[model samples]
Target: MPVPPPPADLTTIAHALQERLGPARWFDAHTHIGQHDPDGMTATAEEILAGLDHAGHERALTFAMHEPDGYRQANDVVLEASRASDGRLLPLARIAPGAPGALEEARRCLDAGALGFKLHPRSDAFALTHPDVDAVVALAAERRGPVLFHAGRGIPQLSEAAVALAERHPGARLILAHAAVSDLGLLAEPAARLPNLFFDTSWWHPSDLLQLFATVPPGQILYASDMPYGPGTFSAFAFLRCCAAVGIPDDAVREMVGAQLDRVVTGADPVDLGRAVGSARLGERSLPLERVASYTAVAMQLGYRGVDATEAVALARCGAQTTGTGPEAELLRYVDGLLARAEERLAAAADDDAPARMAAVLDAVVAGFLAATTSAGVPPVAL
Candidate 1:
């Protein structure tokens, strides 16, 4: 089935807000400029520059994709591109903790004017708290730049592990990319506790971004697209829509969009970390149509098996109701209902291990839904 378009008013508002903010003040904290993946996804420095131009961004932190032969050559590509761009692009080197000479390579990149480092624990198949990863974080601490970690939906480098590492290395500016895309609530307390830990809004989920903005301090959030790898234009547009829909203050939105990142890259006094502005205080604007669509898509994509026709119809009905109400309260109730049904099903499962596994998935879904709904100014409803 074809996806529906967002409401015209919502799109207009998002574009108007984007225009008001202007691109010069925006800095994409995460992006890549090389070929690496088997699917042949590649982005050249010029293409990245054009993307930034199209997005109205003045600068971006650019890095190379993870190369199979290690990132030595890839790092060289990023350095050359940044040098050629004359500072329009800031370079970060991608490092595999388990790779040979990873520490030495990191030091070399830093010396060669690389601004920071990017680590993907899932791709590298290493633990976030591994000694070698610590070595890289220590390197970033010395350089006084951020260490961006890919944290979501993968093994060994979950947000909790990243939080532990950030706690251990107080001096390192650790950025949890994708806002810990899957388990953002898990990072809330850690983000509040660790002044050095930061979050980048780069994932596709609006609910996660809204929760992060509501839960984490403004200073701890950075705007990022993960562009050329993820959809560049869509990501930026979605971010703007989220800011508008959530009614974030203009000044705070400005910081999340770019200013705070400018300070971080320049080694200036860090933006002051403040207490979280809870969802109720943030704003109670109606959820945008695009966001409702996002929520429905996620619900339909839930991997639960044995979803009978009756359950599917109920889920669809809830989705339709959410669209009509345009209120997060309705969506929250829908998710709560789904969770209740999942629990009842698990209770009757014949296999013990099946129940345990299903329970884990349901638990994650419930946590995410509650976080999003709470941030959207909807009180939790008992299941």
Candidate 2:
């Protein structure tokens, strides 16, 4: 197979990690593929397929992006795309749990070949306290299909209700997307006890991923790329590196990457991969990379909030410009190369809003951050 390209190139780093990790099938448990999202993000089925191919993934479970005007049409679009994807794309009905006919819509899509359901309480503006949420989760439970919840950002503390639903319907495969960072600190302990509750690794940020792997059972963590938000190639790169950093065995890494998600979506019971690997297993740390992660995280957040991230980006640049030599310095210089590329893209943007350009900058920051993550294990060859 041909090697995928850089600036967030995976060849050198992934080669080492994959050699150690052995072979594993990748099932991307979370992805968004659509043309019209109110958020200005668009990903066609072809784009998602290319990403899966680039990452050497077998298939991806996808739903519509934020469809504010109801998801009936959006759901249909996804279903049609999946039907033609030759098993490479799996469609999930994006639903507003509180909306009228939500259950009916879910039933329709499920009967029409949807693998599961996607609920974004923040985007849909439901509190999860809505009476319909339980009904929807119960439906998933009855069908043995996975019910993925948006746990990235926004929204209030929702684990209480989620816990209640998971307990009530033992079969409901509950997935908290985006590393479940909204409540990761609070849910780590609870997640250990709830076998059916899972988290999707669809985020950037090394420490956040480090924490998730250290706290949650590997069985409950699934590989996912928020496609269009983040590409599968980078996700696979960072994920494998983190797994190696935490001293997680290749067997557990195999399940975390894809095996377990396949079972959940197919309405099959999930396999137990034993307990979490303690943080002690996390090998040597690089303060430089840690600072690089910090600055990039801030820059990306500022960009998302529609604020100028120039200062943060500059700080990130500074963080990546380490002096002297060795592993830490070498890694910083590699990330610095990627960061410079992001700045170049940002500088070339002359549009007033520069939405597309801004996305490019932020996406570059994500790439730089994740590329830094690979430094946690084997020092990545300079790109």
Candidate 3:
């Protein structure tokens, strides 16, 4: 089957910028390939590879989903699968910080050829300050590897512990996944001092990402898709749109795509993309995109909360009815089409409760944010 091109408006935008930026090898800094997630999300290595092909990404940093039973077997599954991917997949062992033998398992996986580690404070039911966590992170520092944390949700005390851990282990590349939304303001402040600390762009909303891009060093922001939960192509489109919104230089955006990750995976220090310009003075807004952004936020919130978003989607379409004719409005038109398609998909789905239908809704939400970003072409600060 032919791989579909990215959404047309986004593709058009990339084409226009390619002249100055040239092409970049995008690396998805966060992803998963496993079947035993308690949350009912499963993704195969094949699916991730296909997603990479579709998104024009060159490689990915993949690990297992949450393994409540034990991560030893799941870690092996990831290592074995990544071994066969011919460099397209770089394996990261998932460690449950509270689990017994957690430090041993981290060592075992790294010795078994895994590149880094992933820890989920929310799912693993442990905090970063756990006694065993320092041991694992210390091992990562010794090996000069990455230790990616799930910062997707707000967890109590995680921010302070994470800052302390980064300060302690400058050798380990500590990546706070999902835009580090839990403590973007606080973390962004000290991120400049902690050269080893980083953030990955993997969350679903634009508001969080806007602040991340605005307030964090571009060098410290790695492009991530959080595959299985978020499709690679869709997330990549959002990345491109956000990059354009901030008006960063072509070279810096190129680095964010993959080049920077190439270094991070090896546990090497990141190349400087300069300091962030404070988020307080972020410039530009499009009324049309503003409507779409509001709709997107509400829709994602409802969907994730297990609420039906049909009424919200319908109400959103009402506001998008009159976007005039420019680049921003043009993207809004694309967003409107995606929303209509989502409605049609929802209507036609055999099982209304199926994951596909839920994914359809998310697709439109992400597209809405992508469109919203088109208006802020001259991002207030360069870094």
Candidate 4:
């Protein structure tokens, strides 16, 4: 394939973004930050802030998992990180509907300066569409804060009903995290009918962003990086490129993607870390490209491999290419080549074992790209 000329003054765009926003103030709409697994990115409060800073995020609103063994500890960690960032971090608390102190804890999170609540029906063990879940939404409405929910396929009906609840409460904010292309179709009705509903862009394919911009209003969108879930900041950068590609002008990108998150960032009050749990934060003492690689390797173990991951990472590195030549460009070509190879492999892999092997190879290719691109700090090419 013939290489297209590089986008005009891409370096100037990066420099402008770095200067204007001081690392682009990404409000990570949904991240499992408070989980204290020793194997996870699992770092201290100070470490989480430094990592966010290094990743170019000004702030992130994090949520705790709703499972028992460590639920309260997770909330404690999110609280601590929010405090340590001096409001640069926004905390989102988790409430498993039937948990012993679910309601009381959610209310306390509001009092403790949590910006919102996050509900994961699969992990939390309840339907977001359930009557009990309605009480949670009502509480958020009563408190004047937002609620973020997991919305996607093969999950419970709560994702849809949650939209209905948001429609019912116009004053309350309802964020659909990881708004996929399928989600765009699912959310269109409720979002169009309801002004308070918002969508978060995290670890999604770049194509989904294009679909969304063509369909939804710019103001209804928000930028997020599911950090240390880690493709590094490439996830956020891809969103920017997608916005730019779709003729969502730079100012609008900065406004809806950057400034809107910044507005949410500034509203956060720090958690009192002295009394909060320390285990829920990222354990990194400092930022290192290797740390990012290590964390992403875990996601690899989680069986989340896909061709889009490689393409998205490649596109990000392309955007960061200042000279439009050198190794970054070479890597872009490699990714393009790999996609061609993957398609061929997919077709030829008639046996189950062959398909699995091909998928594993693709996953490794993605991992290698992620490691190299992040270390280089080169933005990705627009797909």
> Candidate 3: RMSD over Cα atoms?
4.4
- Check candidate 3 and list the clashing pairs: none
Q: Please say which candidate is ahead in TM-score: 1 or 4.
A: 1
Residue-level lDDT of model 3, residues 1-383, one tens digit each, is 11222333343333444443578988889989778777777888888898787666789999989877989988998898888999999999999886888888998999999998998889889877888788888989998889999997767776798889999998889999999888887887788889888899998788888888888888999999888776676677677667666766678999998999889888666799888744544466767667777886787787666567776777667656763776655566666776776667556755546564566566557556755676444222111
Residue 215 displacement in candidate 3 (angstroms): 0.2
Q: Judging by TM-score, tell me the better candidate of 2 and 4.
A: 2
How do all the candidates rank in terms of TM-score, highest first? 3, 2, 1, 4
Tens-place lDDT digits, model 1, residues 212-240: 77788878888897767443444555565
Q: Is candidate 2 or candidate 4 better by lDDT?
A: 2
What C-alpha lDDT do the candidate models reach, one value each?
Answer: 0.66, 0.77, 0.77, 0.53
* TM-score against truth, every candidate: 0.73, 0.88, 0.89, 0.65
Q: Candidate 2: TM-score?
A: 0.88
RMSD after Cα superposition, model 1: 9.9
* Model number with the top TM-score: 3
Superposition error at 14 for model 2 (Å) = 4.9
Give the per-residue lDDT digits (tens) of candidate 4, residues 204-306.
3433555565455666677765554543244444565455444555556666655665443343321211111112222222223233334334423332433
Instruction: Name model 1 segments beyond 4 Å from true.
Output: 1-14, 22-24, 281-383
